[model samples]
Target: MISLQSGELFDTTIKDLLIPADKVAHVQLGNNLEHALLVLTKTGYTAVPVLDPHFTLHGLISSTHILDSILGLERIEFERLETMKVEEVMNTNIPRLNLNDQVMTGLNLVIDHPFVCVENDEAVFEGIFTRRAVLKQLDRRIKNK
Candidate 1:
């Protein structure tokens, strides 16, 4: 956990708790479902951020999304994974947070999501603010109080 002064707890920002982009596992928009699945499995994450060639936050891709896309009436179409692109199946209507967003703002958003993508003013991918991180901070604040 990132150490914080008791007084600073309520003033915490998303950037303070962010898992920086470089440290996060992600896939590019042009990436195939096969590659996205590999990344999700290797990182032990159900989902990961999707970016364009310039690293702008596009949306999110998940194992569930990949599986759903490849599902067929008769059976799972595993072969389709190699043919489908991430951009074709990613969830574009996702909640996002700015780097300067308050912890309370993140707390609200995380209630419905495991993690929220963070973006800079330029809409460039910064990182993610996770529900676990919010919970940890809340726990620390309670202990201090």
Candidate 2:
């Protein structure tokens, strides 16, 4: 049987819970909108962060954004997605966290957002703390008790 020591759960940090970016599904930076949409369709994630060559976070793209773009047009431009850049439609306003931040801090942000982008002190992207991951921990603790 597995055992979690006392205070172990409470002491957890975002870093301890985050699933590294590479491990999670993602879309590459500068990829075409069609490719990004394909990624989202295949991965089934509502959104994915766009990362540069050095893995610095550029922006996030979501199905809603893509749909909105199509909706804004008088007529659906299916081919436009093929030529559009992800950077052009991606949302630049995103929340972020440092691994050193307490889990509660990360949790609060994630409660309002789908995930919290993790970064180093220098603002280099690292990974993400997803809401599903936090809920999984809660589920485990509840079951253990």
Candidate 2 lDDT, 1-145, residue by residue in tens: 2124665654677788888877766676678888989999999989988888888887789988887766644778788788888888899899988878877788789879989789878777789988888788778877988
* Predicted structure with the largest TM-score when compared to the true one: 1
TM-score, each model?
0.91, 0.88
Candidate 2 residue pairs that clash: none
Per-candidate Cα lDDT values, in order, are 0.91, 0.81
Give residue 80's lDDT in candidate 2 (0 to 100).
75
RMSD of each: 2.1, 2.4
Candidate 2, TM-score vs. the true structure? 0.88
Give candidate 1's whole-model lDDT: 0.91
* Candidate 1 per-residue lDDT over residues 1-145, each given as its tens digit: 5445654754878999999999999999999999999999989999999999888999999999999999999999999999999999999999999999998798899889999999999999999999998778768767876
